[model samples]
Target: MSTTAEAPSSSSENPKKDTEENSESRLYQLVKNLTILERRESSLLELSKKRESFPQLAPVLWYSFGTIAGLLQELVAIYPSLSPPTLTAHASNRVCNALALLQCVASHPETRTPFLNAHIPLFLYPFLNTVSKTRPFEYLRLTSLGVIGALVKMDDPEVINFLLTTEIIPLCLRIMETGSELSKTVATFILQKVLLDDFGLQYICHTAERFYAVSTVLSNMVNALIEQPSARLLKHIVRCYLRLSDNPRAREALRQHLPVALQNGTFSKVLEEDPSTRRWLSSLLYALGGEQYNVGSNI
Candidate 1:
């Protein structure tokens, strides 16, 4: 050929890079706005007092908030290597702001569509592993679990499996084993969601001993539940114990707690009145007393 075809320009060859850079720049601007808004707390409070004063801006705020959440998720996913301890510590703080915005949207059903439709699961998924290992910012772990709980309530398998494979159950159990009552409560909530699936239930059964070894923590959690108004916490504890009893090691470890659980009327009430609880208890009892029920079977 008389003339060589011109080489494509770098920008032309890498359009995606330009698009990503633009997205990152816009995200930085949005985050800056959020920071400014947070710093002007009194102004926001004053604005809140003015009813319908900023109605026109509400949609814009919501959209920006959702976009920030989406951007954080995309950034984390595209650059997982950047989520090291130092970076994650900073990101966790930013996530707190994101969660506040999400909570505001969550409180108003009409404004919740953007979050419920997309932003929630996106923010939640990427933070799973990061939150698990972040120590000094432990609150982020509980916050992350709360987001997962919300997604689970929404019945999203994608969210559930993401949590499962992230080893969230083990991390939660470890936190519940060593952390405060609030931590245990948060962990229990996530575990309750996990127990909804058969594979999750089986996994808990298989690792029952590890969970049961933290009996002192479990006892404290049960005691704390007694003061709570909601019966849901007590019910979840019972279900967790019942599942654990399926494993021989767990059964032996929890044998000491059984009498206390029954005497305290936590398990007893459920065994008497809750049909699902009764069914699970029956299966657990059968599993624990295998020889008693399988007298005719060869060992």
Candidate 2:
């Protein structure tokens, strides 16, 4: 009876061991394929997304393996094609996949600091700076922003400071001014995050030229919204204005140049269901409440 019982237990153990070995084999294939000269970017993206389900995956891919370096290598291999804008859709899609993996690394707390320390994000600036409206280039720009956006989404002030040292603001401002609505919204969200940081707010308000640059993009965004009217985009735009209001100089400027549409109720119906945005709009007005002023070209 004891021998018979042990036999069934051994059979169960065999399948569990086999399953573990199979999983490990698969992971090894994914990692090793990363070193291939013609690597599969889509495979990297799949593994990166899997990190969401397995909390330890990103750290392991980032630290114990060559995931970040592999992705960067894959990205740089295609960098030379951007200047004259000869990048094909196939190439853009491949690089974007690699970017998705890099974004995963940027977002994970354990790997985020080192990712910044290496200045890995600088590799992506060209993509962000691209003016191509072509779908391939647009997708590339948006994916690259995802990496930067992940970095800023963290609560660390260092992330904001590091980005400030770079030309992140100008690049984002350009995207805010010209990218598609979805891209514009993402760029605005990044700016909004930076402004929420005390140092970021001070930095923008530190110079009139800088302040004017920001306020102008915001004004243009508001003008566009008046005609097209995107509630989601408006939400981010309002949050940016509300955060800027925390700065005294910025607050006064806003009061003097707050968009007429905002004060005159163009979005009253738009915000009917968005209580949080409505509250933010109200608070923005109150922050600038001491006086009512006219909207003009000065912003």
Candidate 3:
């Protein structure tokens, strides 16, 4: 009787073990294809671009359990590897695809405010903060900037206020200082959008310290482009300075401290073909004080 009872007990445990194994198999089956991530990003990118077609995308994905949270889980799971900076391209691409999804949410007006309310952008800072020069990290930083880029591109004051309350300005400035040319352009664009807003303009110009911080970065980028020129980047730099000149105090500061490169033919070669950028340069020079500053600009 003892042996019979023992055999029945052992058999019962085997079925439970098999069921657990089956559950594990089910999960692997569910998550097996990394392409699922890629496909989702592609879909969301289309949704962001043509949101009118998929009008209900915002609510469905925003409220879905595994949508944003699932995307974040992908990031948080890889958080450890970022410290020693061991994050791989495969992993970075995966997480960045998820980030691209976040960008979709951020771009959609319906989701942008709530996305900020929930502090979704905060989770991306670490990726932006990583100091690695490797392509993986650079791509991560650029994609991360794209999310912020989407927000500012809307020219919303509430978005700027949310950014001002956070460390976004400093973070973007750091990227402006250390990121790639494309990255710098995006970083500068965010700053430009912020400064374009009436409140953002006042807030940044409220203190001399803040004013100099942004001016210094724009000045540095102009200097760098003197050697390795990017017409796209220069366009935004000129626009940023032009916007800054809107503030009386900032305009006075620029009259004295604006980079000499802008006043001369330093970028004459690059601007020769970029009429729109040349126009921006003209507007910036005109705003600085007088048309005399446009002497050698060749704009």
Give me the candidate number with maximum lDDT. Answer: 2
Report the lDDT tens digits of candidate 2 across residue range 1-299. 35543445545557878986776676667766776656566466566656455455557667756656778887887778888888899898888878877887789899899889999999999899899899998999999999999999996899999999997999999999999999999999999999999999999999999999999999999999988999999999999999999998988898788787777778878888788888888778767873452222111
lDDT of 1: 0.53
lDDT of 3 by residue, 57-161 (tens): 555567655667767877787789889999898888877767766787888888899999999998988887888889989998999999999989898889999
Candidate 1 regions with alpha-carbon error over 4 angstroms = 1-66, 69-95, 101-139, 206-232, 243-259, 263-299
Better of 1 and 2 by lDDT: 2
Backbone clash numbers for all candidates listed: 0, 0, 0
State model 2's lDDT.
0.83
Model 3 Cα RMSD, Å?
Answer: 13.1
lDDT of 2 at 155: 69
Full-model lDDT for every candidate: 0.53, 0.83, 0.81
CA RMSD, predictions in order: 15.6, 3.7, 13.1
At residue 160, candidate 3 shows an lDDT of: 94
lDDT for each residue of candidate 1 in 32-120, tens digit (9 for 90 to 100): 45436353333333333431333323344465544444434433543453355454555555554445444444434455455555544
